[model samples]
Target: MFLQNVFTSYIFLVLGLFHVCHAQHITTSLEGRLAFPNKTPFNITTKITLNSGEYTTYSRKDGSFIIYDVPPGVHQLDIDSKAYHFGQIKIQLLEESMDSPKCLEYAYPGAPKRVVKYPLVIYAKGTYEYFETKKGVSIFGMLKNPMVLMMLFSVGMMVIMPKLMEGMDPEEKARMKQQMEAQKDPTQMFSQMFGELTGSSEDQTAAGTTRRERREQRRVKNQ
Candidate 1:
């Protein structure tokens, strides 16, 4: 009985030691990406704070960051970058293990909301139309002039000529042909065109004949 009691006491002592060790040692890990409001990845400096002290790290080019072996306790995590807004999180750590540690991740929310009493803006000053009571000094009068009419015609020709030339190119012709072939079915095209030319409803054509024409032809044949 004494030997069994001794072994039991030893077991309890060992268990207590194990618990104390687990409480003292902590494994902390950090993982997250730094990004701008647009969600584009960016490198940033990260700081982790514990009860004992604080440590700093930097994010990778891909914006991912990681830190390990932080003392087990409450911590404040901060991530900052010149190109993006800052991010922060609070974490608590308790024990240490060889197993994968929990990572505190962070991402910037975006530009902060603000109330602007008066947003500064600038407007260019110019008169849209200048008019004079003199014989030919009216805004509409200028458009009626031969010089202004010729200028408008020249501008229109310059804009349209390039597009017209592009359509005549062999490559454009082939591209148009391919597009037409992909979009068109001969039977459907024929049916649509015939319906339009004959002024018949699509449903009537689909049913094989117009009701009035069918009735008239049948009556004529019977007579």
Candidate 2:
């Protein structure tokens, strides 16, 4: 009976030591699953992380994952997926177990804590837009450029202005020549030329033509 009593005491002693060791080494795990709006092939890139990657893990074929040994503190949880985007989750953990994760977007004080359901099932809100949306070499874009507009205006003026001068009254033509010769600033001259071509300028010339050719001096408008 004494031998049996001693053996029982030894067993009890072992149990106590194990309990103490367990208490010392205890850690918490976070359980979660990734959900897709559509079927996506599981790849190495699909992963869950906590505290900006102090702890991270990948999902299984079924999209379920468990992040093990999460440090007991505040954490920002994120699911990194190239195929889709997920929402941020915030958590405050005690040493032994995980508390319900809150929606990081609404984690401000005085706001109601949005406690996420346990064994978290995070859903993909939208697919990642990885494709380039830019268009290639548009003609309208080139025509919109100021340099191109200026070049076109110069070419049209060089071809058309000679004919216009030929049909003008000698007094009006000589007055227009004097006004063009007086203009010294190239940028101001370019702006004035562009204004005249676009029909924004007044019909009266710089020399103030008193002739009936003042009506003809206005910009050639499109029918």
Candidate 3:
């Protein structure tokens, strides 16, 4: 019974030692703020990787950031911003004492960038207008011109209306086609109307009868 009691005490002692060593390797935290070239604070996302693990965090509008449980070693820090570009940087972390905290401040090296530039003109009248005119009628011109827009709309309707009328009855479609064709022949309709209004129909008929009578007389004379 004494031997068994001694063995149990040894087991408990080993467990306590292991717990102490584990406590010594406990996690550490790093806190910091991000800044710009002009010392302006902006919201940003950051990705950090170290031998311990990978972590991601976002800085608030005030540019404050905090990362927890980072191992003491070399790490990679990446700042995420499309307009403001940043390359990866190597970060060094030191072992944190139980009484002290690791705090840092970081600044993004990127600044504001312009993507487009307009041409400069000086001492030349109409030079810009001349260059624009050389490019000739663009799609914007067609869109803005009422006559061109009307023609485009008419052509579009011509293409779409046939398909729409396909679902219509054949008799209705035919009648519509006839009416459109008549409307298209404005000159012929106008001539018929003028002839009726001025009695030109009677004049033309009388003229034709006289020519036939004259032709008959000439035939008789020739015989």
Candidate 1, residues 49-75: lDDT per residue as tens digits? 333246666666655666667666656
Q: Of the candidates shown, which would achieve the greatest lDDT relative to the real structure?
A: 2
| Residue 187 in model 2: lDDT | 76
- Poorly placed runs, candidate 1 (over 4 Å): 1-4, 23-28, 43-53, 71-73, 80-85, 93-223
- Winner by TM-score: 2
User: How many angstroms is residue 67 displaced in model 3 relative to the true structure, after the best TM-score fit?
Assistant: 0.7
Please identify which of the two predictions, 2 or 3, would achieve the higher TM-score against the true structure.
2
Could you tell me every candidate's TM-score relative to the true structure? 0.35, 0.45, 0.33
Runs in model 3 deviating more than 4 A are: 1-25, 43-53, 96-223
lDDT tens per residue, model 3, 30-98 = 555555555554555544333334777665666566667766665655555444544344455556552
Worst window of 10 by summed lDDT in candidate 1: 116-125
Q: Please report how far candidate 1 places residue 155 from its true position, in Å.
A: 44
Better of 1 and 2 by lDDT: 2
Which lDDT value does model 1 have at 173?
A: 59
Error of 1 at 76 (Å): 1.3
Q: What ranking of all candidate models by TM-score puts the best one first?
A: 2, 1, 3
